[model samples]
Every structure is written in C-alpha cells, then in structure tokens.
Target: MKAPTNRRRAIAKALTALLPLAPYADMEKIRAEAGRAHLHNLPPTIAVWLAIIAHIRHAHTDYEKLLADGYDRDSARFFVIEQTNIVLTRWRATRFLDADDESE
Candidate 1:
C-alpha cells in the first residue's frame, strides 16, 4: 500500500503541528483513528482534534482502566477529568477541558 495517502498525511500534518509533544505511538494511533473518523466526512481539523482528545482520554488517563475495573463511562470520565486536563496542558492544547462547566 502506498504510505501516507493524502488523508493520512492531512491528519498527520494537523496533529504534528497541533500536538507536537505527542509521542510517536500516540501520533500513529491518532492518525489511524482520524483516518477512520474521516469516513464520516468530518473536516480534517475536527477529525484530528477529536482523535487527539480520544487518544488523551484513553491513553493518558485512567479512564479506560476505570471502565475496565467496573466504573460506568460517565463516572470513569469524571474521575479522569483533571488527568486529561493535565495531559492537555502538557501537549500545549489550545483548549482545556472544564469539568465544572460540563457538570451543568
């Protein structure tokens, strides 16, 4: 297969420019997930950011472990909000998640 088809390249480019601190493994997973999300025809920017957030949620925090250990999705997410925000800051994200704002 030809490497980095245009779609993959577009996602990768956006991620590299946006989340430059992301490790290689994280970037690869984000690129692949973003590529799949593009099938929904979301804009590249939307897809990239969505994938980035999902990666941080699943990889950087205990969100997934909580789910595996029997916490419901919402509760698991609640437990990890600050953790995700920390990773978000470490990655120099333009936006940070605010749990209180979402609590309403």
Candidate 2:
C-alpha cells in the first residue's frame, strides 16, 4: 500500500488535536469499542478520529426525535447522510487509495 498523503496526515493531526472536545462520556470505552469494531485497519490516528465521531454520534440521541418527525426527519437525515458521504469520499480519495490500505 502507498503512504498516506500529506493532506491526510494534516487532517489526522488536526483531528487528534481536537479530540479533547469530543463529547464522549467515557473516552477509553469508546476507543475500546472502536478497536473492537475492527477499525484497526485504518491508520491509527485517522481511526481515532473516526472512533470519536462514531462515539459522538452514537451518544447523541436527538436524532431519534428528528427521525420520528416523518418528512422533516427524512429531509434532515438525507442532508446529513449526503454531506457525510461527500466528506468521507473526499477524505478517502485524497488520502488512501483503498479502504484496506495498511500504510499510514
């Protein structure tokens, strides 16, 4: 596998620097869960940020209410999903050539 691009390194660095701000109830548990979820295949630093995002989103229950609101929920969820997809796609495209790439 190829080395990660400088941009990916920078993003991972920034994400690590911002981890203290994640609203995690128990960071260790979240990290453990992330590891258990088999995210170790990702670059260690990038995986940390992904885990943080996953934990934050998992802990946020407000989405349930939005989801129950029918049309409004559908629109909001669609917007969020699309935005997330775009961001992830861009990140992957500019960073690692493949999801299973082991190079950091």
Counting clashing residue pairs in each candidate, in order, gives 0, 0
Worst 10 residues of 1 by lDDT: 95-104
What are the Cα lDDT values of the candidates? 0.76, 0.46
Model 2 TM-score (2 dp): 0.42
Q: Which ten residues in a row have the lowest lDDT in candidate 2?
A: 93-102
Q: How close to the true structure is residue 53 of candidate 2, measured as C-alpha lDDT?
A: 46
What lDDT is reached at residue 85 by model 2?
40
lDDT of 1 by residue, 2-36 (tens): 22477677777788877878677888888888888
In candidate 1, how many Å is residue 91 off? 1.9
lDDT of 2 by residue, 64-96 (tens): 545566546444444344343443443342221
Best by lDDT: 1
Candidate 2 collision pairs: none
Candidate 1 segments exceeding 4 Å error: 1-4, 37-39, 100-104
